[model samples]
Target chain A: MDIFNKMFGKNNVSSKTVAKERLRLVLVHDRANVSPQLLETLKEELIKVISKYTEIDNSALEVSINNSEHSVVLVANIPIRVRRSMNTVC
Target chain B: MGEVIVVTSGKGGVGKTTTTANLGTALATLGYKVVLVDTDIGLRNLDVVMGLENRIVYDIVDVVEGVCKIKQALIKDKRYGSLYLLPAAQTKDKTAINSEQMKQLCGELKKDFDYVLIDCPAGIEQGFKNAIAGADKAIIVATPEVSSVRDADRIIGLLEAAEMDSPKLVINRLRPDMVKRGDMMDIDDMIEILAIDLLGVVPEDETIVISTNRGEPAVTDKNSKAGEAYRNIARRITGENVPLMNLTIENGFFQKLKKLIGLRDS
Candidate 1:
């Protein structure tokens, strides 16, 4: 099945789907007026900053900019996995 | 005297020209003399959109340059006798006409027509500045997408900075199904973000494309949903109270059956 069928069943691609995809990319670009390369650089810099504080599951963490109506937000989602030996050391 | 209103959007391809053409036609059909001005110089499309490109002998540049009188450039619409068009000069750049010239032209147009609708170009540059000058009101057109909404917000700020009165908002190409599915921003969310008076909401209808291609505005078609929305907007412009169109999708049979069994009303 195609991506549309897999996600929204057999119905035709609705305006909602189009709007969602368009808004996601548009908001990303509008937030900082930055290209995807710049976003990647920012993400890498963010990972470095967080790593200095604590051990994080960097592979699963998401760091990005969100464009809200009133302002732009830097959203960072970090996951913490506690090893038993590491907890004992703490 | 006629009220001059400029239809503007900061982003391109958001249907600013379409809204200007349709609203002008709608107002003319309502017995008001209306003139639609194409202000997108060098990339003029309103003349073609309004089906008056071939009929233009002189344009706004000719009027501003004193090559021809304003009366010579105004092309009357055959369908609506009171409706006319002041076509833009495709050969000249936007700098050919400054904000002062535009204000003077609109001041002259106000003496003859009941409504002068200026179709502004995209972007926040000299062209946009020229379009909004000497306008008593403004209509900001925006699609439901984030980019269009963001551009519209920027345009609203510029209008405020120009000391223009509160402009009405027209949310175009909205899909009811998307709002219901939580996939798109609803009308309330858009209003909350923009903080402008809601003028009208137009659904995404394929008939708009067809009518536009045929050089006929969808507003004249009684069967078109978008047309009805435009007509309602024109009515509202004339200080009439018209209820908003019902663009919600009908509930499916299975959903209705589930609701009945659950004794829920939605």
Candidate 2:
């Protein structure tokens, strides 16, 4: 794809695109008044809460803010090891 | 009553003073009585930009501090009789006047002038607070860059929190050539990110520097494109429905042919 784009010169990912994408992500966090430290705290709390229900790989967890056309989302990718039954957890 | 508008930007060097000077001059040219208030106190440049720096007998500090009347402090423009400027005190800092005094001063100015444009200082500090204190409307000036747009977004958030009417945006210093080359962000990108109504877009022009050097606003020059943009913005402020100016670079025959033959991109 890179070679094809280089040959045809159809690369639309201009510097402006990169700037806009970066701005979109930054502003979502800005307008929401959520700092990077706050996000870190939220990630830690999420790991804590989810650990009771499932055996999850906290080291492999990822969290980020994704901006769509009309809305922003807090997306998390957590690697699950095993589901713990309520009786077993209790 | 006159309408008080604050020209502001969160970041420095974004043409806030130039916009205030030009828009005030344009509004005055439209036969409305206008007074430009320089609220940037110590770092005053609106006077220099408007070419009234040498004539400042008294500043905004004097007027607010009861040392001089507002009339005595206002310097009449050399060109337009209806246009006057209340210059900032070069010695005094932003703390010289607070929000309450600014509100009162704007209230008093509104009774006599048709428009009062407050040139706000850079940063989201006391100067910003004082500039927006008396404003009925706000115009956020920004350039089409990542830092400027981010600051503009932050300013918009601050304005909304203060319950000021949704501040309008003026995208300044846009380079059409760079935008065409995909090296700069276009108008739509800024408007989408800022999420504010665009007041006007001033193309990047060297004429602005020349006009500032001459201490005469570009709006007074018949040939300056930046001047024409400011005039359109003034008309829009008066509730006129002027369309955005065409900013496309006129292509020559060879360039057109090259684009037609797919040898070059638009």
Best by DockQ: 2
Pairs of residues at least 3 apart in sequence or in different chains that clash in candidate 1: none
- Model 2 agreement with the true structure over B9-76: per-residue lDDT tens digits: 99999999999999999999999999999999889999899887788899999999999999999999
lDDT on C-alpha atoms for all candidate structures: 0.87, 0.92
lDDT, candidate 1, residue A51?
86
Which lDDT tens digits does candidate 1 get at residues B45-154?
Answer: 99888888789899999999999999999999989869999999999999999999999999999999999999999999989999999799999999987778889978
lDDT of 2 at B126: 95
iRMSD value for model 1: 4.3
Q: Name the DockQ score for candidate 1.
A: 0.13
List candidate 1 stretches off by more than 4 Å.
Answer: A1-90, B254-266
For candidate 2, what is the DockQ-based docking class? high
Q: Against the true structure, whose lDDT is highest?
A: 2
Instruction: Tell me the deviation in Å of residue B53 in model 2.
Output: 1.1
Clashing pairs in 2: none
